[model samples]
Structures are given as structure tokens and as C-alpha cells.
Target: MANVNDKYAIRMMKADDYEQAFVLWNGLEGLGLSEADSPERIARFLQRNEGLSFVCEYEGSLIGTIMAGHDSRRGFLYHLGVATAHRGQGIAPLLVNEALSALLREGIDKCHLFVMEHNEAGQRFWSANGWEKRDGILLYSRGLESRGLE
Candidate 1:
């Protein structure tokens, strides 16, 4: 699992890693989701999605993670986060690049992710990484309490 960096390793996450990944994931203010995380919710999220997750380990500790999933038409990104302590160490882009490469390899030519309008820093990071922003596209969602969905 060691790379040339020697201090960091990147690989697919396993079931056992979910606990650490959960703590690392929740500490970040990404994904624009409303509900708080619990092990049960994390497990349910994994059940409903089919994709790959890559975790970045530095010095044997989990530092960052990214997940990629695709519907028939396009690839979507979710829950990309780097622990506060891991920021500025070139870990974020590494996680992102790995997910992007995986999507391309899976026959996905187009990929998209949702960033809250208020999350300027996250938007900047995506733009700086060469991901295009599409104008005039609006997102709508129905919560579990929504009439029809439930």
C-alpha cells in the first residue's frame, strides 16, 4: 500500500475502515446533506450506492477519502473530505484525481457534483482542479418526509 511518498498510501476502503472513515467524513462540511451521520446511516448509504471509494492513509492513519458513483448517464461524486490536520499536504487533489480517473475508466465521460451555493471554498477547489461549472442548472430534492417519496 506504500507509494513513492512513503508516508501516504491510497487504496480502496474496506468494511473494517468504515468507523475511522466515518469520523474523518463527518468532520468535514461537505456534501450539503442535512442529516448527521451514524454508523447505521453510513451503512445504508453504502448499500444504496454502487461505486468505488479510495482512502488516503498517511503514516498508517486515515487522512482523506472520496467516493464515486455513476448512474447510466453520468458519474456523480459524493463525500470528498480531508481531515483538517491533513489539509495543505496535497492529499485533497490526490483523492479527487483518483476518483476522476476511476470514473473515466468506468466509461463515464461526464462527471458532476453538487456544492452548496454557500460553500465557496469547495467550489473554488473544484474549479481550480479543472472541473467545469454549468450555469442555469438547478437542483431539487425531496426529503424523507416528502409526501410522495415516503
Candidate 2:
């Protein structure tokens, strides 16, 4: 563990960062981690959606991470997390803003992120940041491969 007072920098997440970043996300309670998060898949994601993902480095240790990307018209955010000891110091918003900023630069106007229904902390974070929870909307997804991608 490194001191928060130490030098810190936020930069794009490289492929090599997959292992450590995966560990960090899995350690967090609310994040849904799965085998699909393997390094190969993450690398493919970063390759297609570069510059929208980032990690926070403190004394060479990864202390935070966020992933944002857009599908031409709208942006989506995911896996925004900061270390337990790093909360309440304004790092989370910084990470979210950076990702959102990147998406904005990509010509995306509207953005959305999914928070588990039970993730009160995440809801508060978004709400406090002026994000309104949409009413009567739902997020649905399915595996492309299951539909015949593979």
C-alpha cells in the first residue's frame, strides 16, 4: 500500500495493466467481475475504444480505474472504482469526469452507466454529481456469440 500523499498520475490503461486492474475490480464489492474480464478481452476492448479508459497510478500502484466508450451517438461508463482507502478524497469523480470528457471529445452527447439496483453508494455518487436516474427505462443485453457471432 502506498500513501495517498505520494505522487499520482492518471493515464490511459495499457494492455499490461489488465492483470492488476482485474484484481482491483474483483476486490471491490459492488462490481460484477467475471471470466469475460480476462486480459485478452480487455485488450480487445481497449483496442477498439482507445483513450476512453484510464487508471490512476500512485507510487506505481494502481489506485483507481474507469472505463468509458461510445457507440457513435452515446457514451457508456463502466467499472468506475477507487481503492477503499482512497474514497472521500474526490478521486472517483475525477476518474468519471476524465472518462466522460474523453467521450465528449468523441462527439458523444448523451451518456449512461448501469449501477446495480442494490448499489446505494454508486447511486449516491452519480446523483450527487447531478446525474438523474431515469424513470421507466431498462437496460437489456445478450451475448452476441450466443446469437451466432461465433
Candidate 3:
């Protein structure tokens, strides 16, 4: 765990955090937001994943967030973001560690996260923090027509 000052507190992310977390992620340049990020969806995710997501707050305002979940095999992380003013304060790593720790507790050993192809800063951050950039694999996605809440 990274040592954060008394002014900052890290805790499990709850449904009530959606509004502030959405604003924080929207202000960030590289995070992709979609209908999957709607309040109802996020609330459901939090309910499904339970303790896997986390947030860092400075004096009661959220400044960082990381969401993690597993498919009963490998874990995946999403939407790791720290406020611009708090970028260099180790908040991001702290959030990542918290999520990873939670995943570990749930018996998940391996984890993955996607960084946008153009997000050099995000790439650098992940690499510098000991995450490997995998080769010889490609991500394929197909969007199905929305039924109701998907």
C-alpha cells in the first residue's frame, strides 16, 4: 500500500459515488465513457462486484477511482483515473493496489486493463507502475444492438 497523507482517505466505492466519479472520468482525456457507464449500469456493477471497486477522496471529494471485476478467472480493471491536480501524489497507484488487493482476496491472480492506443500518459503510468505491455494478442470487440439497459 502506498502511503497517503491524512487528508486523503481510500474506501470502497458505493452507488452514491456515481455522479462524482462520472464527472471525474468525463474530465479526463483518455477514458472512454459510454452507455455502459450510466448510473443504473454502474450501480449494478457495484452490486455485482461488491468490494472490488474503490475511490480516493480528499476532504470528502472524490479524486481517484478504480473499478475491478473478475469472470471467475482473470481479473479486469477499468476507469482508473486521478484528478489532474492530484496526479503526482501516488493516488492512482494506491487505487490500483486497493482493487488488485481486493481481487486477490477473491482468488483472482491475473489482471488486465485497457489503455487507449493514443493515451501515452496512461501507457507510461501503467508501465512505470510494473504492469507489462503484452504482445502477440489483440482485443476484438463487437457491439450488439441494445435490448434494454445494456
Instruction: For candidate 2, write residues 1-150 as lDDT tens digits.
Output: 222344767888778998789888978878887666888888888888999998888778888999887889889998898988778877787788788889989999999998888888888889999999999987777766667656
Q: Which stretches of candidate 3 lie over 4 Å from their true place?
A: 1-3, 146-150
For candidate 3, lDDT tens digit of each residue in 9-122? 889999999999999999998898989999999999999999999999999899999999999999999999999998888899889999999999999999999999988999
Candidate No. with top TM-score:
3
Q: Which ranking of candidates, highest TM-score first?
A: 3, 2, 1
CA deviation > 4 Å runs, candidate 2: 1-6, 146-150
> How accurate locally is residue 138 in candidate 1, as Cα lDDT from 0 to 100?
82
- lDDT at position 47, candidate 3: 96
Worst 10 residues of 1 by lDDT: 30-39
Candidate 2 — worst ten consecutive residues by lDDT sum?
Answer: 1-10
> RMSD in Å for candidate 1, one decimal?
2.7
Better of 1 and 2 by lDDT: 2
At residue 51, what lDDT does model 2 achieve? Answer: 90
TM-score for all models, in order of appearance: 0.81, 0.89, 0.93
Per-residue lDDT of candidate 1, residues 17-127 (tens digit): 778887786677754544635666656655555345678888888888787777857988877888887688788788877877877887888889878778788999999
Measured with C-alpha atoms, the lDDT of residue 98 in candidate 1 is 80
Question: Is 1 or 3 the stronger prediction by TM-score?
Answer: 3
